[model samples]
Target: MSSAQVALLPGVQQFLDRQHGLFIDGAQQAAQSEKRLTVWDPATGKAIATTADANAADVDRAVMSAWRAFVSRSWAGRTPAERERILLRFADLVEQNGEELAQLETLEQGKSINISRAFEVGCTLNWMRYTAGLTTKISGRTLDVSIPFPPGARYQAWTKKEPVGVVAGIVPWNFPLMIGMWKVMPALAAGCSIVIKPSETTPLTLLRVAELAIEAGVPEGIFNVVTGSGTECGAALTSHPHVAKVSFTGSTATGKQIARVAADRLTRVTLELGGKNPAIVLKDADPAWVIEGLMTGSFLNQGQVCAASSRIYIEAPLFDTLVSGFEQAVKSLQVGPGMLETTQINPVVSQAHCAKVAAYLDEARKQNAELIAGNVGPDAQGFYIPPTLVINPDANLRLTREEVFGPVVNLVRVTDGEEALRLANDSDFGLTASVWTRDLTQALNYTDRLQAGTVWVNSHTLIDANLPFGGMKQSGTGRDFGPDWLNDWCETKSVCVRY
Candidate 1:
């Protein structure tokens, strides 16, 4: 908390004062409604910028533009090598502006500037380059089907993967820049044009990135940004007839709403929804390593991560050791503004979000849950919440059952890894889960039984560029990385010819 605050770069200052507009068809314009939303810096809770709040009309324009581009093959028609070059150029531009984007994300999304740089911007740079690498890999297979429909006719048949069409991406406020790219990058790699609707609170970085796409030589309508509330623009974009697929990352409730709307049109959807993600510490795991891994997985970005391990199940014999370790680790976190170099826990994105986390804590206290650490009182400014560690939470408590999406972690004791796996798989949300063990067999045993996407052994929250990420069960559908992402973004067409 004593660390000095980092000075703002001039680019961040200019962006903070700018009045931004919706990006459609490679052009920026005021929203049709002319309504706007003020941007805020979470560290100071100050209004820093304003951006157009697109209404239904603006949604229509963006979608239609993307649809036209898709239909006309403006972006999709390009050769894979051409697409790869442009995407690589875009990645390079993002890398060059990394500092500006990281600061802007910290200002808008409320994570530490260091995290914004390392995880948000830095990881995004990697994903962008990886997705660009996937351009040539987006392909189909040659299949041989035996048939006797015509006695002496020979048949040549094959299958091809084609871009689905115009895509609609709705991103959440937490880690906006990174998650937005999760939706945008793959769709582009598969040659599908896209329109992104960033969360109202964290729209600035995406808006800036869209403009940079132009500098990277991406065509108009290939990458678009629309900023507005979910009810207005989000709903409009998802349900639009021209949209072939909608990729959404948010709460379970909102994801369901989008699925319902997309259902009417049979539109494909890739939803990364809510998670009560679990981290299991088996009896054989070292307490020291478990403590360090959980500290990063649960407290990074102040635990705004959807895949964050909020619900932790420790084997009974090792439970107290971990509880003590986590308590001390949580207490040691330097809670302050993210711009400060020494700040380990930053404020949540908004006052409303802070209050939401507060309500859960209040309810946990009422349910007789024990808080061993993270009750370091309020900061003088901003929407801050201490990194809270709760134990002995009531079985029925929402703190243990739901995704707090904040720096609140719940610890439960289990008899063994069996019990830990059982309890971990006991949630409706299974976006991610991790198991820690020295036994390779035990870890491999979990691969088939964890019932979640992206299970990790000995680590958690480590998202790799080559691995596929997404939830199973209600954690949501579809994958987000590597070749699995391309599968979701494209449709396969089987062609047969008689020669």
Candidate 2:
């Protein structure tokens, strides 16, 4: 499209015009060393922003700020009702600034403007509101004790839930804004001060949101954002002695490292990690409906979603028809820059990621997988790859077993629901899976048997703030969303008194 004809999202240009910095002590500050990372516009494969590259010194400063805030009770000392008010106000500010945040996310992260608006900003707002409601509900129960202290003395026992002091949250490049919200909001609601380490690749949206948070009347040092390479800042934040809890969302390898570090300190940890999720289409599933579910499960957000269904298992009876339908849909997608309103498929996060996804295709051909759709080629100057589907790649191949984390999927044929179930559970990842079928009995049976944290029946990747979302096994430990997340940030203390 010509420059004259290009339709840009509101505030896209305005966000691109400014220089962003890190958020610490409720203010925007530059890196102490005057270093910056060149953030890429993956859509155009151009440098759009220079983000402050926080070093160990910066991480220490943010952690100290959070510790002071926690000790002083700037946020944690407030009554739950007051915290709720501030958080609800923060949600309001997020809603008010939704357009700018969405546009900024689309520019930096290279996701569609529609998705940035709906999922990045809109869903974040809902999650914030949901968490805000949980603030006043963080309570403990009174218990009766069967003990006597000093001859027939009455005893009372109760428990109290307290914030785990300072929290460190590390988010990934994909879904930066949404995942950042996932980390910070619940911690803040629980009255714990936080230091956020966003992916160096996409730090703009998090920085801006932290600014909005302060504007919503959150006290200083309650929420801080540090931007830099994971090796330096992320390692420093997770290893810092002052951080009482660590909440990280990224690769399983990184999550393991964080776990090891946090374990040394005995710090509370919650990790939402990687997935090579499967989508199983049972024999009773309709081919047309199943194809739509497959597309959404496999390719939403250009297939960068961790819970995105990358491995597809189809019952033998429905294999031919479902595969043909999926191929047609994949071929019809429009791949281009997110700035164009007409584009359906956007570029992957970077040139490096694009190459990683491309290599999988080369290996698939060598392994004799049937390439049903997509082509590996550079689209203009952007890091674009067409939505791809391969049929029956060897189950043991890297493309089949590992997370491609791009717009690519593998289709496998299974004889029955039992075979499909066996193949689906045959993986190191147990993040999520989807079972498409009209048979309610079969769906329930598979739901009980699937090793994943969440199994969708006739749907995929549908998330709600009320429902818990996380992975089992190597996918990661703990959960996000729902009331369970609130509990993870708090420590239960039991008190006993004799009268």
Candidate 3:
């Protein structure tokens, strides 16, 4: 498509034309260092914009600004109702600019624009509303206490939830606006100031979000963003003394690094990391349903989701039907730029990622694994890797075990549910899994037996505002949903008084 033919949100080009900077204290601040990261449009593998690359100094500046805000009680000082009002306005602003945010998400992150609108913009509004509503409802409990510390002394005890102070949220590249809100809303609802570091590759939308936050009357420095690489800015932000909490969503290895950095400060940390999730198809399941479920499950966001179910286990009896149906379904998906409403499989974020994912598929062929369906599309232009299905995968291959984070699927035949459970549970990652069956007993059995954080009966990737979404074990700790999830962003303070 020619530049003249391509359509964009009216605000997109105007926004991208400016030199992107680190967002701090409700303004765009130039990076102290001269380094800048080129923002790539994965669909065309073209440089769309350039943003300042933050170093440790910039991270320190952002974190310190957040600390000053927290200490000043600029945001946390607001009454629950006032805070709620601000957050509601923030959500409203986000909705008002929905077209532009969704466009930036699709342009930078390479998910379908329809998905960017529905899942990204649509879900974010609902989530923000839900989170905002919880603001006034946050409360404390008074407990009856019997104190023997002193003669004739009556004791009263209570526990209250307090914001955990400045939070440092490290978001992954996929679902930038949606997941960034996942981290931001809860922290904001809990009355904590935050400094978020977006994935350098997809930092544009969040920068715009920061600007909108200020427009919504959020106090300066309460919501800051540092755009840079993991080694420099990320390490500094996670290790900063003033940041009371660190919430990261990324690879397990990087999660561990963040954990280690936060551990030094004894800062609270929440990690939602990598997964090699499993999807099981039972004998009683409809092959068509399995195919449809796996379409989103295995290939949503080009399989970049941490909870994406790539390793599929189908019952032996239903193997041929499910496999053949799935193969056709995979092949039928439209692979193209995310902006098109018809496109299903957009590129995998970048060419480097394309190569990394393709390497795994190449290994599958080297091991004589059956290529059921899929093709890494045209190499010269876009970073497109359409839905790929590989059968006859060996248990020992890296392709079988590692988190591919791409459009690659591996199907295995399981003799029974027990076999499925055994094979699925044998993974280092336990982010999420699903079992498709009509038998309530069989599905319920796998629900407990499956070694994953979130288990679905017949669905996958269907997230809600109330779901306590987090990973178990290597998938990482701390959830990001519900009132309980909001609590993770706060600290419990017990108050005792003698009267």
Candidate 4:
């Protein structure tokens, strides 16, 4: 694989020159205590920055700042058009700093610069612009009613969507910039204040986003970022009394814990958690197309994507052929540093995560799963895991049951479509799944039986800003994007009057 082309932009030094610490109440501030944590560049395993480690006291300050902003006239009392203008300006600012933001995201999160440019930065810009249009469209509904007490009196009732006050937006590290936008932009569009606690592994892009948001004329305390470990900062934010809601994106275990904490205040919560997604290949499907789809689905973003198709089910007739073709594709993928234009597969997020994946592979081997190809980690300073495929996986094994969250896939064969549906729905997770077939009826039938939130007929891992994205069952609860997402950030109030 080719080495990355590291051409730092002219303004990057200036951007990096700015304080790289917690942003509280619209300004860069030191941690409540003097403690700090190092941020690493996963591509090269180098320390990029040492950010302040916020504690409970810092969480108190940030949440209170956001609470004050939520109730202040400058934020909560602003007209929809006024809010729209700020959001539009924020969108423009994102575009202005698009390249720099994309570079920071790639350097910090271990995603390819190409993906950061195209998906992360591009989607965030689009989301801000889209939510700007939605701000003015948030209207109340009128209802006509009858009054029983007085014969001459008529009643009027209506419902309006109002911001739910201070929101704790706990974002995941997988797609930091874009997912942060998913949590913050919609709440801001609905006229709420937000306190973002980004994942410890990838917090730089979010802090930079908050900086740009303040620059775009968002009021002080309207948007804040506090970075620290999940146990310290994350738990505090969720349990804080002033936090009206918690928007979290991470693993199922953490989401459950957040849900429990939020229950104390009965605070609303939106959780986008883990997935052990599946992809089904029919007998008559073309080998070339199936191979391409499986390769992209199983290894995209080094398979760290939450909705990636990790568990593959193929019909018995074509099982061996599909596995063989997929092994070849995985073997030929270009794995290297993320900034390289020619690199297809980048390193995993960290050395610890690489070791975790290695342990999973070892477990699979002990359980007698057939390793198809590519178990070799790159011999370098980075956290690299070669794309690996295991065939005829044991249904009860950890690799098949739990989320591997790496560039690893397990292939299994089924007798027919019925067995395929049974095996696909057998797992505890049901986030996303795909079915590849030329027959439309078979596709529709299979989709109906698959237990997941989003079902792709012949594709995999394709997401749009306008579609509702989340999971069913143990995967997660609540949704992101689409029209329903506005409901996730706001609460509905009913008003009735008699005249």
Candidate 5:
């Protein structure tokens, strides 16, 4: 790579040198344990900074603070319109600071700066605005009661949607700002105070956002962040007595552990876990379009996306042609640091993740899975893996069965759309899947049978704030985004009276 290819944004180093702390109550605080974790830049395999590592005590303090804020109703007590204005202002702050946040995100998480700006900061701004709009729209209903009572007696009943109290928002490493917003915005929009636990690997953007929230006039303690590991901080948040609901986005295994902890407390929980999402290319789909969708679907975020099109099935007629195009696209991607404007494949988040992704390639070799495209090892110093593709792997093989969570995808030849659906629905995970076809009838038919939470036609990995997004089966539980999320963050209370 040349100097121009590795060029970084100015001031990235300055931003990293600043000390970061856990955001609790309305301020930044050192963890009671006085421990910290080193934030790494996977793009260069370098340590960026150390962040305060909170433990159980810190979690308890933050949760209590959130609970206090909720009960005091400083934020919850505000009129919907008032809350809306405040959050909209927060969105403005996010937009104003977009470049800074995007830089931090790219450096901390090793995703392309373009993505960090367009998807992370830009999408989060949209999410905050959308959730702000929801504040005014969150409502309950008046119900007509059927009562067998004395003549002329009248009874009426209505329901009030109440916030679920203090919320524990556990976000994952990928798309830290967006997922953090997804977890916290809805809870706050529903008038619930929240304590956010960002993945230790990527905490910079969330911490900054919390500060911006305060500046935007969100009441102190309405949003808090406790940075630490899953064992100490996350476990504490899950079981905190003040935490009425737990919203998490991470691995299926971790989600299960959190679910068990939440279950013990009977806490309301919403989980968005892992996915081995499938993208099917039907025979009738345009070659050029399907090829574009396949490349974007599989390689976006270096395939770190939970709902990435990691597993692809193509009808036999189009498999060879589509795979050839995909291979060319994969080969053309420029792999380098995120700050490089031309870099298409940025480094994976960490060395450990890169190794984990490599193990799948080793397994593929052992199973004689045809290597369609990719480099098994990093060509550069950072935790990088070239976009990888595999073909002809056995249906039950680990390569096809597991979530690689890297820049790797599997291509399988199917007889037709029906066979494609059968193979696509075979996974235990069903977070998302996409079908490319011009046949509306076949697309709808496959859409009805594709066992995933969000299915796309002629597109992949596209999401919006107005839509509900979640997983089915082992992929995880409950919905996020849109009105349904507001309901999930709230409890419906029925009131009836007789006159």
Candidate 6:
């Protein structure tokens, strides 16, 4: 390979340095127990590296370290402004190393470097910077009241946002760096110590982030990383007696499990789980714009996004036009190595995920759903599944009901605008949805009853650091971005003063 192509691959030394093992007390160390996990590059089906996979024993050490740091004067005694400065520096470090982190994410997550650089790493920087500013701004308001029995008596009561103790942040594989930042940045900004458990498949970038965070002046043990499986280390973190909170971003099934374990000790939790989001296209919508929006919304990140518009409802009047445009858009997408700058759609995360998506396609075909474009996959070599589109898909079909988390979209034709809205809300998952209509009145009317946390009009899948992101029903609870995100890791305590 040429120098240019070598530059595209992950720097071996950087990868080894970052992917060493559990990061605790400001140092990288092996797991307490002898467990290991093999990381892979899904784009080429190659083994990237092996790292220490922490179990319950490792989780105990991490949580204890974090707890000690949280209560110690070294971290908890620091003023909010001081914490803000360190976080701002950390954000700058992330931006300075954005290219390297983007390459690691592309190598591990099987996402295009274009998408990783433009979206994932960019979003991480924005979140870190945004949260850095929010640290000093987190405050409570005072309330005035008079005693009913004693007219002369008065009450002065106010609330303070205090940091919860040790927080365990278990992030998913998709958008690993961005989601990991979402879980830890707000906690750190709120003056809480965190033990992050990055998904085993995509731990390299997150481990790199930990090093940068410490180098940026975050106190030792204030931010730790434990790379391991969810069943062991993740469960231990969530159920540990000392850990004050658990914030997880993964499947609904796993979220339920975590909630059950957290409930045992009555620990606080914020779960950002799965989504089978929908996109509703009304009759008055612009076909060109709506089609483009749907294509990007459903197929972006190879459709590995939790809030990706997987289920789409189009008005019958413009269904044919939208489908035709969508087919052309998918056909025009470039699928290749993630390091390639021009590739739009890369391989799925792993062979198992590719197989699951292929099964859905096969089942959809057996049930008589029409394949609109792209269903070519079944290879064990690279785990590549072409962006797939299914027309007139049944609502009960697995492809429509389940979260495929791949580049597969199901299109359903509705009678009208009202029917479009009705069909869109039929699913159990309601993370996000989009309305593509030129009529302002129709867009506003539809937006009011979308039943999802976010409703994008004339566009789709556009996220910002200032907006709160999460789901309503099965999509999961609690927000990930904005000032509100800080509330998830901190508890509000009311204090009263009488003079």
Instruction: Give candidate 3 regions above 4 Å deviation.
Output: 1-6, 375-380
lDDT of 4 by residue, 323-384 (tens): 77887788787777788777888888887898999899899889888886664444655888
Runs in model 5 with CA error above 4 Å? 1-12, 149-151, 375-379
In candidate 6, stretches whose alpha carbon ends up further than 4 angstroms from where it belongs are 1-6, 9-14, 17-19, 147-155, 375-381
TM-score of each: 0.97, 0.97, 0.97, 0.96, 0.96, 0.95
lDDT of 1 at 34: 80
Give lDDT for model 2.
0.87
- Show where candidate 1 strays beyond 4 Å: 1-3, 375-379
lDDT of 2 at 443: 89
TM-score of 1: 0.97
Model 5 agreement with the true structure over 1-499: per-residue lDDT tens digits: 6655434456556767877777988888877878889999897788989998887888888998998899999998999999999999999999988888888998899999889989998888888898999999977788998888877789989999889999999999989999999988898889999999999899888998998899999999999999999988899888888889999999999999988988888998999999999888888899998878778888888999998998888999988988888888888888888877678898999889989998988888887878866543345778887788888687667768888899988888889878888888888898999989899998998889999999999999999999999999899999888666699988999999997
How much is the lDDT of residue 292 in candidate 5? 84
- Higher lDDT: candidate 3 or 6? 3
lDDT of 6: 0.85
**Stretch of 10 with least lDDT, candidate 4:** 372-381
Q: lDDT of model 3 at residue 369?
A: 82
In model 6, how large is the Cα lDDT of residue 43?
Answer: 75
Give candidate 5's TM-score: 0.96
State the weakest 10-residue window (summed lDDT) of model 2.
1-10
What C-alpha lDDT values do all the predictions have? 0.88, 0.87, 0.88, 0.86, 0.88, 0.85
Tell me the tens digit of each residue's lDDT in model 2 across 126-218: 999999999999989999988844778898889999998999999999899889999899999999999999898888998888988999999
* Model 4 regions lying over 4 Å from their true place: 1-4, 13-19, 375-379
Which whole-number lDDT from 0 to 100 does residue 247 have in model 5? 93
* TM-score of model 6 vs. true structure: 0.95
Q: Cα deviation in Å at residue 424, candidate 2?
A: 0.7
lDDT of candidate 1 at residue 326, scale 0 to 100: 90
Q: What would the C-alpha RMSD of candidate 4 be, to one decimal place?
A: 1.8
